[model samples]
Target: MTIQTNICPRCGKPTEEGLCPQCRAADTKLLACEPRVTAVYCPVCDSQKRGKTWSDLRMPREDLIAELAVSAVSIHEDAKNLKVAVRSEDTASNRTACTVEVEGTLYSVPVSETCEVEILWQKEACDRCSRISGGYYEGIVQVRATDRKINAYEREVAASIAEQAEESLQQSGDRLSFISELEDSKDGVDITVGSQHLGQEIARMVTGALGGRYTTHPKLVGEKDGKALYRVTYSIRLPFYQKGDVVVSRGGYFEVREIDGRRLRVFDLQTGATRTLAETEVERLLGNVRDAESALVVFTQPNMVGLMDPKTYRTRELSAVPWTFPVEGQPIRVLRDEEQDRLVIVG
Candidate 1:
């Protein structure tokens, strides 16, 4: 087989290099220079524009390097299987310089190039952050207790619910999903949300978990482009009696076991039966047993038991169910119903 070659113009010789070895070497040296790119980012938000949408600033440093690496280098159309890598990084006072290496095949020839890219960050507030600083709010959620003052534990729970809801909604691309402010008041908790939909969502979630009822009221706040705009107020009312509280309603003594929506599951002290009561029926709360001590069970009977009260240190006969009897000398819960003038044995 005869080897094919090209005639060099300057050297006047048949050679495979075409332009001769000297010219070919010079061309290769010129081709191995560098790439070209310009990367811009927001200094305030630390976010970069990826297509039309902005990327999350919370991404790690390595992820940012990988993202900028591809778009920073300009590859020729003849190059195939192009790959980019970050070789080194230099961080200055306000700007960051990254040496990006690009490797690919140009016309079936392996070639590599590196370029230094400076990430220029400009100061600008993102849409969400700007709106938040502008005190933009679409709705207010007011948390209150029904026929009682809000407790600290319940207030904390409501606040946590609002925070979790805001985070979840923000991740779903709702840029306006945020809690602008959380205020603890005598009534309960007030959460200011960036969107009326988010306010309602958080209110519902808190009420569902803590057993309460909520209602929405719209108020005309302003006008936008000849259209009237209204802000919503979500009023959430928690249950009057929480679990483990002794309450009296309609001349009946009962202990609240569970609360669901506007209804409550309670155990009747008189009949030793479990039943549910509507919110409207729970007229008033007589008292709350913050704590109860185990009393000494002196005598055990089928229908009644004699218990020595821990507070009073006196033996009292309290009614008990046939199956709910405590053993003699064992401890039992003896609750005193001051209004009913009787002792309740809740074992």
Candidate 2:
């Protein structure tokens, strides 16, 4: 029988096949890095652009720099246990210089390589920024109260809700959804949005928190990319009676708790019970619970409680309710009924 042994062709060393591990590893290129790579970003919003797509930067600057550097490097397919280290510095205002070092095993032999890569940063306007600067909007939300103008508190709530909705949508990757402008008009607050989705969200949230309903009206604007485009206007009307209002209904004083259309869910101050009343049954509006006065309790009886009137500085007796017990020498909440010349216990 005859036996044959394989030998390395280039080094004349004993091997399995054509070349030994050390010779093959020496001949292979472990890492190849491009000399330069361009990074495009928005100057206004700092959004990064990659292959004709713009996205918000979600990584730190150092990590992003290292990623850009490593992206320009190509590793050999036969390399194993590869490790890369990158160091970068800003060479100019829009330029960065990077050094990449790679260590790995090729064909069972350790190999290492280092390369230099330069990154050129270019700035351009992003989609959202461009639309905002151009005063482009797809929808408007108009907030108004029923039969009256919106108050300062309502206006503030609307504006705050709009801003929160914008932030939520932007963070959820809806880049085009943004608030273009928030304006306060004579009637109410007007919120202009870049997308219909943002406007709808703002209107829904405002009404949900402020007790109101909204209606949408769409107008044909034009056509884009063979699709018909329409601008929407969301009209929101708040209820007449808001929460915390103290109103007189059917010869009884009640505190408004919630407003649902023409009906109001109220707490009966005289009986300490919760009941619903129609808006038309309300006789008059004395004041809101927010305007209640702090009266010092002078005396407490079995059927009555005596309190010092904050305005008159005199002791006044009021029929006590079973809901709240007033302790002597403590302050109790009272709402004044000017027509009846009396102090009504609020709590």
Best by TM-score: 2
Steric collisions counted per model = 0, 0
Q: Which pairs, if any, clash in model 1? A: none
TM-score per prediction, in order, is: 0.69, 0.85
Cα miss at 170, model 1 (Å)? 0.9
Clashes of 1: 0
lDDT of 1 by residue, 164-219 (tens): 99888877777678888999988889999999879988988997777778999999
TM-score of candidate 1 against the unseen true structure: 0.69
**Residue 292 accuracy (lDDT) in model 1:** 55
| Candidate 1 local Cα displacement, residue 229, angstroms | 2.1
| lDDT of candidates 1 onward, in order | 0.74, 0.92
lDDT of 2: 0.92
Clashing pairs in 2: none
